[model samples]
Target: MSQIPLEHILLLSAVLFCLGLLAVITKRHAVVVLMGVELIFNAANLNLVAFSRYDPSLLQGQLFSLFVIVVAAAEAAVALAIVLRVYQHFKTANLNEIATIDK
Candidate 1:
């Protein structure tokens, strides 16, 4: 049985990153945008893990990925808190409807 190539993982991560970019650009819902951000973060993490698996000399990629995961978790928490506050103030989570405070 043949093992899968690391290039395949990189390609998949690229596709996911593109899809997340599209979602962030096209979606108007706050939660959907958040999901897109998470997807992008995961794609980057996937790339890090893939590189770590393929390169024996670098354990740093995997360690960096762990740090990214932790940061992503904190980002999610803060983002969700902000989203909830926006929902409470606006009564909806649609990004299009949420006006800038200064505007």
Candidate 2:
């Protein structure tokens, strides 16, 4: 049986990262942007896990990936709180419309 190559995982992660960046740039909704950020985080996680699998001697990547997951969870909590506050203040979740707080 042929083993899957590490390059395949890296390529998949890269594609996901690019898509997430595009979503963050082009989406107008705050929630959509948040989702893009989550996607990017997951891409980094996939890369870490893939690297860990390819090279068993390096456990740091997996440990760092765990830390990343924790950080991502905390970020999501804070971001959701902010989004809720924005919705409460503006009565809308559109990123463009939430600029009223800029003053």
Candidate 3:
């Protein structure tokens, strides 16, 4: 079986990153923003794995990707906890309203 080209993988990663960024910027819900951040992390992971395929010996890219995954998981847990607390305090998950309340 022929391997997929790196360029195609990178292109897909770029698309994922852009879509994630758009969601993070345009969506109002805290959960949606978290999902967007996940998408961005996934895009980076994809790129890392794709590049790792080229030099199988070192495995640096794959290792780094694993580290990133771990960090992302921790980040998600902490962020969700913060969001939950914010929701409890504010009674709403809309980021705009949250920001307004801060002032």
Superposition TM-score, candidate 1 onto the true structure:
0.91
Best candidate per lDDT, number? 3
- Candidate 1 residues lying further than 4 Å off, grouped into runs, are 100-103
lDDT of each: 0.91, 0.92, 0.96
Q: Write down the TM-score of every candidate.
A: 0.91, 0.91, 0.95
Which residue pairs clash in candidate 3?
A: none
User: Which lDDT value does model 2 have at 72?
Assistant: 97
Worst 10 residues of 1 by lDDT: 94-103
* Pick by TM-score: 2 or 3, better one: 3
In model 3, the runs with Cα more than 4 Å from the true position are none
Error of 2 at 58 (Å): 2.3
Model 3 per-residue lDDT tens digits across residues 3-103: 99999999999999999999999999999999999999999999999999998898999999999999999999999999999999999999999999979
Total residue pair clashes for candidate 1 = 0
Of candidate 3, the 10-residue stretch with the lowest lDDT total is 54-63
Give per-candidate clash totals.
0, 0, 0
Best candidate (score: TM-score): 3
